[model samples]
Target: MSTGNTIPISDLITSRPYTSRSFLRECPERDPVQFPALWYYPVQAKAFTICSLCYNTIIHGFESGCGISFGSFTGTKHQTLFCMFGRPHPKYLYKKGDFLALRTFMASRTGLKVTTCHGLGGANANLSTTWYKPRNGEINGMVSCEACYEDYIAHTSFSSRFEKSAPQPAGQVWACDIAVPLIRRTLEACSEGARNDWRVFVAATTHRLKVPACEPYKERAAQSTRWFQPKDSLPGFIICEACYLDRIASTCIQGHFTSTPLSSGQIQHQKSLTCMLSYFPMAIAVQEVIFSENFQLWCEAAKIFMHEELCDGTARKGKSYTLIVKDGTGDADFNICQSCYTCCIDLFGFGSHFKQFDMKTHTEAGIAYSDWACDFYPTRYGFSKYMDALNEAVCVREFSVLGDFIARYQGVTQPCPRSTFVKGRRWYGTSDFSACPDCFEETIQGTALESMIVVRNQFKETECSCDIYSPSMRGIWKNACDTYDYAGFVELVRHRASVYWQTVPVMKRLLSQQRIRLMQQQTLNGSSMLYQRLDMSASASSSINYSGYSQPRYTYGAADVGYGYASTYGIEAARLGQQANNLVQSSRSDTTQVPYLEALWEAVE
Candidate 1:
């Protein structure tokens, strides 16, 4: 309902809009709702200045310079923001009020009854209630300001105690948490086949691209139904029109890193999967195979991600992938022992190290260094990274052979369920402790029966361990034999496509968890690969040039480095000490006896 009465709307608004912006050093609340919005306008813009205490009305603005019109003019500086008088909104002129009716009664009353004398007062009881109504009317349903109302409710909402566990007949019990599904969500990772086609994949995990509008600003915000780019091929720079305004107008930097998915004019070709691949560690190493470049600028940047003074190739001797650019001078080449040369070329990516060592005594000094390739090398591995690469290499050969075999044999592939063989039944949720349903039931029954026959048996003494004696567990083994879902996992294992689909997510999770553990370990160990490089540079005074190569003058890991990655690592080390204490305090005899098993489990992850 417009009151049909109005004043020139002051250049202000009542509420603030929230913005999460990066690279915004500071943002002041001053601008109008349009353009860059500010929380408050310096002046109400009514008169030169307005009332500060009650912002609803203007105070004095006659001759003060803050700007604009009318009324008694007092030539004062604009420093006093508000008028000394009471402030009320312009709407006050139109709001109508109602009057109250009279006389509801008010009185003081008392009543009593007789009782037996022994009952303490012939007194049955005496009661009195007092009420005073000077004006004989009722007042109720008074309203409060938004701030005061919020404060009142916040202070009074909980009747008595702080929130904790929900009350139950027992002390407290665990809530039934929502179960996370075992499926992997494949996001808009434009598949390999699509890369060669017109539809280009954009870098978006959260937001989707919307259809492009010729005049985007004139339109109401578009729905995320289509990509802005008209062409099938993705563009080199994938930036949205809206993102540009946010950066330049709103000072937001979030979308600056992302590229616009829409292409202009002719669609640029072949710009897909590369964006997804870039989000990986050693991305350059992976990308180098896709593109023919020996190196890219992005690769060089990533090389220094975790290590400094580290060569792109290797420092050990004998190994060379591509010859170092020698400026056409033969003297640029130097004599590195074969062992050193091999070590140099092999250790390339993150946490990726390799060594050819004497199998009998594989310590640093015992390393073969550059045996190059032993006949046994076909089957032998240098280190874990090398082993993975080698295993992959062998697989490639077998893959080709398998390809030939399949092509000639001409039989349809019976989709094989990978989960059946890739891991134990427990991994697929088919069985616990790697045993099938029947085997597990049989073992538990045997153990329970044999243990029950002993001298201090659970079947006889209440004093016997309740873990083996409890009535709740009495029929558990028998129940397992009858009601277990033996068919559910069996079906999952037999269906190749479904099993592999679920397995992919499980593998991805395991890899992620493993990576986190590795980073934590690297943080704790003072001699991590990155730390090793820093230690070597700690005392080096100056750079040394051998022939054409220039030595490093300073290690980036110096004490004054801006981001000291190692500084917070001590907290993790302290957490590790705490974990050790907890494990020591635990009473599991099996845990104490097989210490290496527990340690290996943590280390492997």
Candidate 2:
């Protein structure tokens, strides 16, 4: 309490009339100790000699020699900017813009009365002057209140007073480190591009780093982060958790970018979040390989060079092969990979920062990673090797993706001729793409192996004129075949694993009228004396192209195998040709007699 005589409180307290609060506590064994000093709540008009708005605490700051000062509270003082004991803490926390408008930090504390009052528990209203320190010497612009002071003393142990105060937080630097390094050498899996930019400095209330100790003093320290932590060697970034969450939602997930310069305020905010891709490294791998610019180039390239058919999805049916209905085709076309089929290409969007996918879902589906990228592997991944990375970017990107496989590791450049002719089969041999002649009939064209009966006959060479290899026949076949190979699955399921059916005999008169030109006697002129019938029969084993699906059980001479390449070529040619030529059609094959190709699927009996 202040004295009318103006005696220094330090000297007056030495007279034994006043007692320290610590020594004044109640003890049942002793009577109340007599002392005159009352609780001095500092939250009053008398507590401040300087106004926060108009005041400058430094008395001799940055002047000449002895550039020192004292706070308004000390009668005899020394160097240092001073106000009360330390930076005063205001009672209420302020938000970003609120700090600048604040005029006064001083507010009311506990009310005082003339009469000395005691509580039932013997607790008295008495506070030590040292109860409120400078928040461990860190600058606090907040005004102290009775509750805050009590809170301060509650946690501050008496032993802590002798210990040195914690160091003050230095003010913040206005700029963040501007250097941005490439996430990787290649953006293969990275679906988006990023601008090299300065780190964002959010508002002071949630400043990850310490800022200026002013009217709006900083608040929380060591707040939780909302981003992937930078590599240990990299400089740390300080963004508001709000800014980070919003930035990710727009940049990564939605594949968007902002032209607006960043302010401390953010357009996006969330209650809570974290980096979405922090866990999946392979997608990170894919993203790193695919640069945004390069990905854009590839998308453009695909728009140009991809077959005209694929542009119209509904019009293009994937791979064409024979179905069970009597020589009908599956009518297939190119197809997308399993990944693309399941998710939209827009997920990466022209190239966004966050182009990630769930590998676990793919694994749960039991799909091989190869199958997942089967389409992309052959075409898109290798684009960079072929074209200029920038100018011919489209083609380069496209080549990098779709055609690079040809140049990469010197793999096959063109598909096999039979696969082109028979469109519905997926030929997975030891190579990326493969086809053998025999496999053409059973798998490619979806014909059954066990159903065909081979016939052997002796025909005079002079009469067995190889006439069916005509240009007209090939021309008609060409019209029906799909030239552009569509990305797709060709029913390449394990045929050997399928149950087989032994031959069942069905008699039909051998007709020689449909004989097509033989292999044109290319190797040996007219070496084959045997002429085989082309009609579907069960018992005989005379077909030239046996199930390429498997090898023949018994060895057979050339004479026994009489049919030639023209047999398959001419009939389809003739069938399509007759339709094109408007020629009268023959009776359709009896499909009811045909055995199921397999119990699960259409396989040969």
Candidate 3:
């Protein structure tokens, strides 16, 4: 337990009954009362406390021989100090200037101002009045809080470039620009080069920050400006100017790309362009290209990088060939495409686990064909775990170790206990619908419904109608949880289901008829009008909040609706109703339109 002059590990780690009410920023919710905490008071008015783990990790630097000991203080008689670091210690183990050297060394590293005001404890510069910003006064100029300025910039060669600024207005939150990765990288580069030119730094930072964001999967009707596409390779591949500068411009492979021409007129068709370097696997390929300085090799490898597109199982038209798990059964029937196999399996040395599947042959043999979907797609579940397992296998140099992890995903046919519905079992429900264990756990367990869940005993193995995948259901649950309105939640769910069943089919039919008419006309003007109407209808029905999550606008007529739901829903309902009436009237007025109902009746035969 003992390590030289240090305190025994057993003594330091022993559980204690005492608990502190105050919580540190690192562990904001609860105090880990069992471990000892170090409290530092630089002045009588201010105190900062850190748990033992933080003390060892950040302050003590985790050196084995480094230890705290009793020491005498020489400040003031009024200052009732416990330890040299501001805690009390036994006089028997006291040694003169025990922590003086350590404190001085730490102070030199963090700077005198930071040590005096914040001590070894961390500080948030945004809350401090002494934060500094660039003298140029640009709106997007670099700003560093007091702690950051002292700890990172004060000791550097370009320390004098910054000047103290007034604290932000009360209730307004501001963050140190140095916290941004790009800004931090720029600062580091300046430090490494020992560059004291403030103008150059500001210009570089401002220019980089002002560039448009990198959106690889953005679909535009016309060609985009300031974008780079690969020359003579990967036809639809494009990189934003920002991504080009940040990731590829400095590399030797930059010569392989050409600037995409700006659109001269409105384009009739939309094209989705994906940046090759933005995808992780392609980024790795680019890194390889950078190291080898071989652009052609990257082009060959890049052909297999499908930019997360789903494989359609078409040998001639598909971006990549379909790859299925060999001898797979039950849940192990993985339909990974060649792109995913290269990135997730072959790239990690697990190629032997899979093989190419002949989808054409299987279809000809009276088998149903489904489009190949990569189980390890970025957005799919278990993807993170699969990636972690692959990395771990590579790290340990045992490629066969991945087999056990992959086996967990195979040969598992039974639904999870949560998703299963059993007869004579109690389930959470309302009068209209009962949620399976899976649905309850995911959508209702921890919410306001926790107390209000109506337990029901099932008489038969009936399918649970609770659709957790429905965005409307999710939106309703979120709103209900936020407001804690159990009655409103039940009524809303029932109303939504009723309205959806009645409306969706009619809406689909109308949309289909409109699509056929536009196609028959074959005019750009007609297509534009149809798209405009669809956009208007969609916007009127659903509005996305600032957080980028879809906030479904449902029209509920419930009387006891809580927190503005009644008024909001009523207004949205009236608007949607008017739009629906207008659409129906337009369809009726179209004398030249084909009768879709008759067509559907004939096609059914």
List model 3 lDDT by residue over 18-103, tens digit each. 22212222321111122122343222213223333334334454333434432211222112212222111111112233444444
Measured with C-alpha atoms, the lDDT of residue 306 in candidate 3 is: 42
lDDT per prediction?
A: 0.25, 0.24, 0.48
Q: What is every candidate's alpha-carbon RMSD to the true fold?
A: 39.0, 36.9, 21.6
Could you estimate the TM-score for every candidate? 0.15, 0.16, 0.42
Candidate 2: misplaced stretches above 4 Å?
Answer: 1-176, 181-224, 227-274, 277-402, 405-605
Error of 2 at 383 (Å): 12
| Model 3 global lDDT (CA atoms, 0 to 1) | 0.48
lDDT of 3 at 46: 32
Ranking by TM-score: 3, 2, 1
What residue pairs clash in candidate 3, if any at all? 82-87, 82-88, 83-87, 83-88
What is the full ranking by lDDT, best candidate first?
Answer: 3, 1, 2
Error of 2 at 599 (Å): 66
The CA root-mean-square deviation of candidate 2, after full C-alpha superposition on the true structure, stands at 36.9
Off by over 4 Å in 3: 1-132, 138-155, 163-184, 221-225, 230-234, 251-274, 278-284, 287-297, 306-331, 348-350, 360-366, 382-384, 387-404, 409-605
lDDT of 2 by residue, 462-569 (tens): 211111123332222233333322121112212211321121212121111111112222212222212113312211343344556433233322332333233332
Q: Please report how far candidate 2 places residue 578 from its true position, in Å.
A: 94
